[model samples]
Target: MATWGPEVVAGAAHLDRPVRWLHVAEAADVGVMLTGGEMVLTTGLLLAGDEQAQVAYVESMQRADVAAVLLGLGRAFRTTPAAMRRAAERCGVPLIVLHRPAPFSRLTEEVHARLVHGRFAALNLSDRIRSSLTTLNLSGAPLQQLLDEIAAFAGCPAVVANLAHRVLATAGDRNSLSELMRDWDRVSRQVAELVRNDPVTVGPDGWIVAALEARGQRWGQLVLFGHPGSEESGRMLGQRAAEALAMNRLLGDRDRGWEEHAAESLLSDLAAGAARPEHLLTRVRAAGLPVNRRTFVPVVVREPAGRAGDKGDRSDKAADKEGLPQLLDRILAEEAVAGLVGSIGADGTAVLLSVPHDQDADAALERVAVLTHERLAARGRRAVVGAGFGCTVLDEVRRSFVEAVHVADAALAGPAATAVARLRDVRLRGLVRLLRDEPELQAFIERELGPLLENAPLLAVLRTYLKSGRNKSLAAQVHHVSRPALYRRLESIQALLDVDLDDWEQLTSLYVALLAHEAQQAVGPEAAW
Candidate 1:
C-alpha cells in the first residue's frame, strides 16, 4: 500500500493481513490470475467507469481470496468509487486507492521480495528447531529434556502423555496440567486420529497435539500450548518432536513404556533408602497406587535360577522378569493392596504393600507369598516368593525389603527349594551365604578338609563321626568299620587339620566349616573349592 501511496478507506481492520505473494493484472477477469493470500496490486482500468463491472471485479477478487485490491485513481474514475467500496466492505477485503500513479512492477518486486524473505525465515527457524532436537536426541538426552526443547521453541507449556492421557513428562514454568488433567479425556477424545504428521488444536485455548509414533505403533502423544508459528511450521515441529521422542524411547531401556517407567522409578527410589517417607507417599499416590493399607510388607519373588552352566543366560528370564511383576500387580489388586511392583533382578521381582496396621499382616503377607508362588507355577512360571516381616512404620518397610532380598538370596543358594523363605528360615545358611563371597571363608573350608578330601575312605569316616555327634560307636556303625578303624580315621583327620577330636569347641568349629562348604556346593560346584 505504501509503494503506491494508497489510502485504505474501508476494511481497515483487514489491512494487516499477511501478504504471501504479489500479483498484477490488467484483464477484466483479473481474479483468474490470483490465488488466496496474494496481494492483488492491479490497475483495474479495463473494468473502470462501470458500477456493475466494479462489483463483479471486487466479487471475483473476494472469491479468489486475494489479500487486498489496489485501484489506480485516474483510469478507474478514482475519488473512491462507492460500488467497489461497498463490495470491499461487504466482502471484508482491504481496498486501497492509488491517488498518484505508481509503477506496479516495483510494488510487486518489493512485496514479493519481502514474502520470500519471510518464507525463508520461517523455513530456517523450523530447520534450526529440527536440527537442535535431532542433535539432542542423538546426544542421549532424556525425555524431559526433549520436551523442554519443544516447550522453549513453542514458547509455551508442553506435556507428554500416553494414549490414555496420563501425563508422563511435562516441561513448563506455569503448567496447565491440573487444568488439562481435569478434563483430559474430553480434550484427548477430541483429537482426530492422525494418519501422518498432523498436529491439531483440540479447543479454543490453542492446545496443539501430535502423536508419538513409530513402526505403525503410536507410543504416546506430544502436546503443546499456544504454538507460535504457522500451522505448517507447527506441524513440522511436532512431527520432528515425535520422531525424537520415538528415537529416545528406542535408545532407552526399561522406560520403553510409561508404566514400566513409573514402576521402576517408584521401586528404585524407595529401595534407595534415602527417599523421605512423605515424598515417597506422594510419589506412590501420583503413580495411582494404594496407600491405605494397615501394614506394609516387602516380598521378593524370583523364578528358580536358570542352569548354572551360564548364569547370565537370558533365554527364559525375559518371561519371568516381565511376567512376575505383572502377575504380582494383578494378585495385589485382587487383595485390595495393589501398589508398586518392580523387576529387581534378572529373574526376581519385588512388591511393597500397604496393609492395615491392626490386622495380622504377617500372616496375610505369608498368604500372599504363597498365592503368588502357586499362581506363578500354574502359569508355568515356577517362582519362589521370599516374604519379609511386616512393619507398621512405613520407613521401616525399606529395611524389611532389604531383609527379604537377603533371605531370597540365601534361599536360592541353599539346598532347600522352599517357595516361601522368611528371614528366620534362612538362619545359618543366611549367615554363611553372606560370607560365601569372602576369600577368608573359602580359605577356611579348603584348609580344614585339605588332606582328607582326596582320601574318600577316611573322608567318609570323618563325615559319619561328625554326623553322629562324636558318638564313636554310632560313627563306626554308620561307616561299617570296627571301632579301631573309625578311631584311626578320626585321629588321622584331627592330625591333618590340627584339631583334637575330643574337644567340643574344635568339633563345633569344624561343623561350621562343613556347613559353609555345603552352602558353597549348593551355589555351584566350582564354588566348593
Candidate 2:
C-alpha cells in the first residue's frame, strides 16, 4: 500500500505482474492454501524467530506462483528479514515491505473489489459480443457481413483462413486490408501453429489467432490482425467470432468445404446479377481478389459434350476427383494470378480473373489456359476452356461471365482444337447456342429439318454431304458408300425434303437448320418444338 509508505524490498522488476486476487495470511505455510496470481499479505508473526521457516515461506510463495509477497513490519522483526529477502530475490518474486503499519483487511477489500469489477466487465463484454453475433447469425447474414461485425468490434482487421492457410474472407479498413493481403500467402504461412483454443499473439506483428472447429474437426482459423486492445478482451472477441463462423459453416452447406463455398457464393452471386455492383466489388475485395482498377476476365471450363452425363454422377465424381475449380486455384496460385474460382452447376467450373489494368489481359488469359490444359492433361482429364471479353469496369464482368458460359456451351458442340476457345473461335455456333432458346429459331429448325428428323440414316447421309461441301466422293467416303450409292441417297433426300442439294443458297439454309437442330439436341429433348 503506497499510503502506508510501502517500499519494494526485493524483486522490484516483477512489480507489474497481474494480481488475480489479494490474500491475507499470517501462517508460514499459507502459500500451500493459495493459488497462483494472488498477492499474499502477512505480518510474519509466525516466522519471527525461525530463519529456516522464513526462507521456507518465501520459497513456498514462489512455488505457489504468487504475484507478490507483502510483509508488514512491527509485528514480526520490525524490518525485512535477511533470509526471506534473499529467498525472494533468488526466487525472483516481488516482495514489498510495509515500513509503516498497513491494514491488511482494508487493502484486501479494495483490491478484491477492483478485481471483481474487472471480471464482471469482462463478462459483460463477452456477453455483448455473443449476443450481437447470435443476432447476426439468426438474421442469416453472409459470412462477410459477420466478419465485418467482428472487425468493427475488434477495431482491427479480421480474417478467416482455411487449414491450408489461404485467406477466404477478410474485414477491416480497405487500405490496411489491401496492404495486408498483398502478401497474404507468405504472411499467413509464417503464422505459428495454434496449440490452444484461446487467442494467442503470434507472428512478428503479434496477430491474435483462434481456431474454428466444430464436431471435433478444425477447418479454419479466425485471426485478429494487429488488434490494439488488451489481450484478454481480444481473446474474448476472437473466441466469439470463431464460434459464429463455425456455426455459420454448420448452418451452411456442410457438404462443401469452406473455401469452395465462399468462392461459389461470391461468383454465383455475381453471375446471377443478384447483388449490386458495389456490393459485389466489396465482396470480391474482401475475398482477397484484387478489384481496384483491374481487368476482369470471366472464364468457364467444362467437360466435352460426349463425356457429360447425369448431373448427379458428374457432381459426385467431380467432388471425388481433383475437380476443375481446385485445378484452377492451383494454377492461379502458381502463376501469381489474382482470381476467384468456383464450381458452377454440375458440369462447369467458373473463374473470374483479376489482372492489373497495366497488364495484357489476353496474355494473362492465354497463360492461365495453357497452364490449365497442361495440368489437366497430366491428370488424364481434358476440359474445354471458354473465355469472355475482358472488361475494366467491374459492373460489366457479369456480362462477360454470361458470354463465357455461352462460349463453353458452343465449344462443347464441336471439336475445339485450341486450349482456350473465345467468342470468335466458336463463331456462328456460339451465336446460335446463345439464341437457341428463341421460339423463332426453334420453329425454323422444325420447319427446315422436319422430314429429316424421322429418317436417321438419310439425315446422317444429308449431314455428311452438306458438311463435305456437297462433294459426293468425300461424302461417299465418309458414309462408307460408293459415289453412285451416295448419289441415289442424295436424290432420295432431295425428293423427301423437296430441296436441291446442288443449290448453294438452299444448301446454306439446310446447314443453318442442321446447326440449330444440333444445338437444340444438345440442350435435351425438352427443348425441341
Candidate 3:
C-alpha cells in the first residue's frame, strides 16, 4: 500500500532501479533486513565524508539488502554527494536524492489511508460471511455441514480436530486429510508448540498455517496449502471463521440441554405410571434405556415439611429430570428395574424400578436402599425415603408404591437404617404371623359358613365359577348373585389379589382347594391369606 511505484522513482534524478521501502534509523541495524529488494531511508548525518565512512555506509546498505539509497537533499549539502551516489551505483542500488524537500508527512498519510482501507475491506467481507453463517444457524450444525462450508470458503480441504488431535470433522480431500491426521495426537502436540511462536505461519515455499482456536482453547490447526499472496488477509478470515464455529457449537449445546430435559421428563412420567407404561417403555428404549426382564424396585421419598422460619424451596424435591434420575441410574447399575420412574413428591421421591433376579428380594432391596442413602448423603441431601420390591405387573407395582411409602415413613420415624423395609414386613405378613399362633381364632371362622366358611365366600365363588366351565349364570346362581353382580364381584376379587383371575383355570381350581384352609387352620393353627 505504500507509494513505492515508478512515479516516486522518476522524481529521483539518479535512481533508476526500483525502490523497495525499508526504514533504517540505526547504522548497525541494516544486517537484520538483508534479503534483497529494499530501499534504505535515513538522515545521512552520520557520514563524515572519510573513505572508510563512505565504504561503511555502502557496505551496510548492501549487506542489509536495500534496492536503493534515499538521502534528504534539503539538509547541509547544497548539491547531492558525488561519492555516495557512486558507491550506491557500484553496489547495484539506486541513489535517490530529494530536491526541494519532499513532504514525508503527506507520504505517510497516503500510505496509512491505503493500508487502513485494505484492512477495513477485508473485515467487512468477514462480517458479511459471518452474518450469513449465523442466519443459517450453522454454528453447531452437523460437523460435516460445517466442514463443507469451510472447505468451500477456503477453496481447499478443511479439518476439525479435538484437543487429542482426533479428527472430529473434515471436508474437501477428506481421504488425504484423514490419512494425514491419522496420527493427530502427535500432530496436535506439534501444532501447539508451533502456535507459541505465531498463530500465522507462511513458509518460504508456498504453505500457510492459520492456527485455530475455540473458547480460548487451541482445538486444532488448519493448514491452507497454497501460494501466499495475502497471508495476513487469509489469517484474518480464518480467525473469524473459527470464532463463528465455536459460537455455533455453544448454541448447539444450549439447545440440546432442553431436548435432554424433555426426554428425561417423558421417561420419568412413563416409569411412574403417570403416563401409559407401555408407551413410556417404548420411548425409554428409543432413548437407549434398556427394559428387559430386569428386576425393579420402587422408592418413594417424602419432601421436607417447611419449617416456621423456612422460605419454601420444594423445587429441589421436584423430579429434577436431571441429577436425581442419573444418580439413581448410577446406584442401580445392572440391577436397576426397567420402567423406573423417579418423581419428586411433596415429601419424597417415588421410583418405579427394576433389578436383577435374586433369591432374597429383601436383601437385594436393602443394599439398594443403603446405596441410595449413601448417594444422597454424599450430595448433602436427607429426604424421608422408602423402597418396594420389584413386581412384574402394573397393578402390583402401583400397590407396591403405596406399601413402599408406608415403610419409608416408618423407617424415617424410627432410627435410620441402611436397609429398605418392605410393607409386607410391617403389615400382612406380620399380622399373619401373630394370628398363626392361636387355634381358637381360626376355629371361629370355620364354624361361620360350613363348607363355604372353610374355603371363604370369595374362594367358593371363584371355584364355582371355574368348575361350571366359566359359565357366568351357573356360577352366579350358585354364589346367589345376579349375572352382572357376579362379573363385578369377580373384578373385585381380581383387584384384591392383584392378579388377573381370567388368566388361568388352574388358578380357579387352586382357589377351591384352599377353601378348607380356615378349617385346616382349626386342625393345626396357621395364618390365613
- Worst ten-residue run, lDDT, model 2? 520-529
The model with the greatest lDDT is 2
After superposing candidate 1 on the true structure, give the runs of residues whose Cα lies further than 4 Å from its correct spot.
1-18, 24-27, 43-47, 71-78, 96-114, 129-152, 166-179, 182-203, 212-220, 228-230, 245-258, 265-322, 344-367, 375-529
- Lowest-sum lDDT 10-residue window in model 3: 1-10
How far is 172's C-alpha from truth in model 2 (Å)? 1.9
Shift in Å, residue 464, candidate 2: 34
RMSD over all Cα atoms, model 1: 8.2
**Global lDDT scores for all candidate models:** 0.70, 0.80, 0.53
| lDDT by residue for model 1 (1-529), tens | 5655779876788987877787887777878877698877766777777899889888898899888887778776758889889989998899988898888888878777887887898789878988898898889876667878888888777877776766576666443544554455565565534223544433334557887876678767888766766666676677777777888787777434766676665665555454456444434543555455457777776666543432333766564457777778788777766457887745667787777666676666766777786776554556556767887666677667777766776666553355578877878766776577589998988877778667778766766677777789998888788999877888888788888978887787777677677667654311231
Instruction: Give the winner by TM-score: 1 or 3.
Output: 1
Poorly placed runs, candidate 3 (over 4 Å): 1-147, 183-193, 201-230, 249-529
Error of 2 at 178 (Å): 1.8
lDDT of 3 by residue, 487-510 (tens): 887776665556576667535434
TM-score of 1: 0.60
TM-score of 3: 0.33
Would you estimate the TM-scores of all the predictions? 0.60, 0.60, 0.33
Clash counts per candidate, in order, are 8, 0, 23
- Colliding residue pairs in candidate 2: none
